[model samples]
Target: MIGTSEIILIFGIVIFWIPVILLIYLSIRYLINRSKKVHEEKTALDILKERYAKGEITKEEFEEIKKTLDSA
Candidate 1:
């Protein structure tokens, strides 16, 4: 009981929504990855600060390592 026009309309709607769905999915994935990276960087910086506080490394060494971590 389906007409040709209805079939074409369904196809058009699917094509239009496919990319929209893909974009939404990709954006969410990118945001999640970015959030994880930021968390990891902050954790590294906190650990570095803790090491400095514990007297494991000198100020100069802490600064140098912090600079390296930030650059990465």
Candidate 2:
């Protein structure tokens, strides 16, 4: 059988430490999700610009895509 002091310590840890640990875990998870969301929020035009800057697309292709984006 557990002693009274041990029972009190266990209860205190259960009531306080559990929530504290959970809060920390949730906060880290939320921050990671938020960062990923920000990265995924890049627009089509932004991607086009990146491709053009990287020389992955020709000037003609860039202009064509830009015109298409503008018409939309």
Indicate which candidate wins on lDDT: 2
Off by over 4 Å in 2: 1-5, 8-12
Q: How far does residue 18 in candidate 1 sit from its true spot (Å)?
A: 0.9
Worst 10 residues of 1 by lDDT: 38-47
Q: Each model's TM-score? A: 0.59, 0.66
RMSD in order of candidates: 6.0, 3.1
RMSD of 2: 3.1
1-72 per-residue lDDT for model 1 (tens digits): 999999999999999999999999999999999999987775788989999999999999999999999899
Stretches off by above 4 angstroms in model 1 are 42-72
**What is the clash count of model 2?**
0
- Candidate 1, residue 33: the lDDT equals 100
Best by TM-score: 2
lDDT by residue (tens digit), candidate 2, 1-72: 899999999999899989899999999999999999998998899999999999999999999999999999
How far out, in Å, is residue 44 in model 2? 0.6
